[model samples]
Target: MSSSSLPSSQKQVHLLKRPGRAPLSTEILNVVTAPLPDVSNLASGHVFLKTHFLSLDPSMRPSMDPSKKSYRPPAPLNETFWAGGVGTVIKSNHPEYKEGELVLSSAFGAQEYADMDVAATQRNGFFYKIDPAKGIEPREYLGGLWGTGLAAYLGMKEIAKVKKGDRVLVSGAAGATGGLAIQIARQLGASYIVGVAGGPGKAKYVVEELGADECIDYREANFEKQIASLSDRPEGGMDVYFDNVGGQTLDAALLAMNPNGRIACCGAISGYGGSYEGLKNSFVIVARRLTLQGYIAIGTFWPQDVYQAAIAQLATWLAEKKIATRFHFYEKVGVENFLDALKALFEGKNWGKMLLQVDPEWKGEGSKSAAK
Candidate 1:
């Protein structure tokens, strides 16, 4: 499919009601036809992009909640829901933005078109141009390169404040961010990289594919014992902990940190659906002088230097065959499938970043390519 044929309208996902006690319903959200928003009079700094891809993320689940201030605002009832998406500019009122430019933003109601104050919505810089001639795929921007990759790179390098020769432990090591965190730790000269993940296959892949020095299966009945057995002395304790899965995994890391160890609290995918029992090992922070830092990817705190550099390096890694990637594309489906895609994330059924292909150009087995 050529880019010219890509749909140019209000491509949107609608959420009917709150998911009460059970799982969110795919049937509840039905795409409705609405007039394409007129952006001719949009506020300055506001620009519109014809969305090509919509990122499916676990953090978005909390947005469905009716509560007001739980990280992000809840989706308004009976209205079109919003999300992070990448698109090409079909129209622009902002002076700096030109029509036909590609960009990414935190704007929601991820329809085929979006209008927002480009200055307010653009994170890590304005909608970046997507060079279609490059070997890298356009979808990568929504997944590893844009979403999870930035999460891992920023969480480890900046938030965790890692240093060479330090020992690092990563939880949820098979997922996109966790997997990338492992590699970044290794590249930063970590002495040993330990991975904690669910199931045997993930553990094996963490070691084999991600180059983890060791991997512990969290599903094993002797999970704690397995983690304990891998220890030795003062140096045996981890210097950095890159946490993606929370709950037990966090509790376990709190138990293993060396004095003055730092932790990058990226996400708690383990407790994604709802609250879980809080950590019992809270004492460790005081006992070990550990620093726990939490973050969301935005503002000056964002790892722009690391992110842009990594993208360039990632292309090289792919060319040199030093890095590998995997994706679980949920083929061309309608806006109503939003709940199903989100459910797959919370259930851990998805292996990498989940993305919705809103444009026909991205519907096939392969989409646009960037530099490899």
Candidate 2:
């Protein structure tokens, strides 16, 4: 990994076909051996990179659908699949970049090597330089301090505007972003936080591990009743809600919010595969006078001053133990395993951040950073 030690060709994942409502399979994402980037003549603003870790997230699922209108374009057919990842600079033609520097970029195709134009990455939001001297781990960047944490920070701090004594509720409480939302709400001084998760085990994790006052199991028939009962409001409702899973959970949260409550609409995982008619309680927004706003992270939706300052605050909380985090690591062995990892995310199998070490030889657990 120190340099381009790759052979004549390397394995790569390509969008062979889009998985539109059908069951996911290897045929959708085909892996084939492809030649490495020609570092012989690197592009002007480009640097030759060796991917170390790839972030396997739910966001990738939407980009798979070419017909869907979203925050960005679909992954081009037959191209190296689009993804975010951390890597080492094997060689650099860019004046500002140097060999051996570790950086994270938004579109480091889910392959071993990518020729990145650092300027383009910077222009878009995160060509983030992982600072080893800051006492944060690189893998941590992939977890709580990067996109995931950034989402939680935006949802809880900026969008929801959670204040002291606010009774907050979070759906997808055991998953990566939801897990952090609980901790961030606590840091924001939420008096009593209730989490909505899929099952008993995840509910327990949300309560005991992630510091929620109580977590409701959505699998139960009376899950909505459970949410309604936790409200400390005079009308028996939550003051703020951070939504990740949208479907019945959103409907339930809608019925449980107090008048003028705030909701940070983050994701709709339950409806990602298209069957998401989960919000029957649309009238609740009108009935309760709620403020709900949807946003895209690592993008130009917010001002840089607000975004960067929030990111720094999250890192500070991570470093100061003001916040806690967990990561779910999956080593990239079979290209099919990456697909499985995505399935695990959609099925709520991951406990925290879901990541794939794209480099097969990297064996170290990221409790400590790769560089430090």
Candidate 3:
């Protein structure tokens, strides 16, 4: 559809307020109708876009709190929430971007439409053109191939330095990044791949579908025991630990690590909303001579060359069926449903990558039922 023919108003989910120690609520987000962006005034290297899917991730929860110190700035209150999304350009004035072209951007707001400046987007490090002929779905880019997948790839390959026959463990293994990280570990030739999740279903999916050798239910009282039981400790314990859930899980993984084991710290969702627990097993890191490294997928932390290399490899792996994509979709939901979808991340409700469909016409192939 053309920009001129599009609706004059669009729904937006704004950060109404920062949350307290409790889980996020509707009061923290304001869903309102806002003026559609005017693309008629063609600024050089700008495009008008209609968003299709907005990615829901645990990282977003911490970004909501202005007081929370992070690598990136927190979401400003009363502003349109920022997120990574896939969309199509309906109007364009850029040399590289054309109208009707599909694109992926990290700067798209939680709104139905956006006016993007390509030069500014590149300068801010947030835009990419999506090739429709690649046989990859737009939403997949928001998960394994582009979003969490890139993080998983970098965490495993670069940070953890995963090698052939290495025993690997990934926490939050049923979620987007963890799930893909398991598969990536397998591809990187992990002999014994162990996944840690919350329930039997997730554990089963992590093992049977995502190809983890074993999956431990973190909700079980014997969560640490299970990790020890499954890990090949004699072969230098778990060679690499890809940590997605921090706190107790990291502590447990630390206990199970072999001498000189490497840890790739991707996220700590366990302490997102001010709930944090000290790692009692941290002493083991020094005792075992373990290496722990924290990384961010974007910004100065990750090298641009490494990011590009990871993306190229991920695309090839995805196309060749070396890795699979799974998502827990919030289908046909409007901007008002944003906070609820986000809450699903912290609640351990989503089976895979959580996504919000802002475009009503975009039919998703994943589960329609919202995470309960």
lDDT scores of the candidates, listed in order:
0.71, 0.81, 0.83
Model 2: how far is 203 from its true place, Å? 0.8
Clashing pairs in 2: none
Ranking by lDDT: 3, 2, 1
Give the clashing pairs for model 3. none
Enumerate clash totals for all models, in the order shown.
Answer: 14, 0, 0
- Candidate 2 structure quality by residue, lDDT tens digits, 224-279: 77776655455367999999987778887888888899999998887677766647
lDDT of 1 by residue, 1-372 (tens): 233443445546777776644566755555766666656566677776676667787776666775413456677777778777677776667887778666666574557667677666665333566666766666666655665776777787778877889889998888778887888787777888899988888888899989998899999998866654444554577889998877877887787788898999888876656664488889989988899999875445545676567567656765565555556555545454566777776666666566766765543244332111
Count: clashes, candidate 3: 0
Model 2 Cα shift for residue 262 (angstroms): 0.6
Q: Model 3 lDDT vs. the true structure?
A: 0.83
Model 2 lDDT, residue 301, Cα:
85
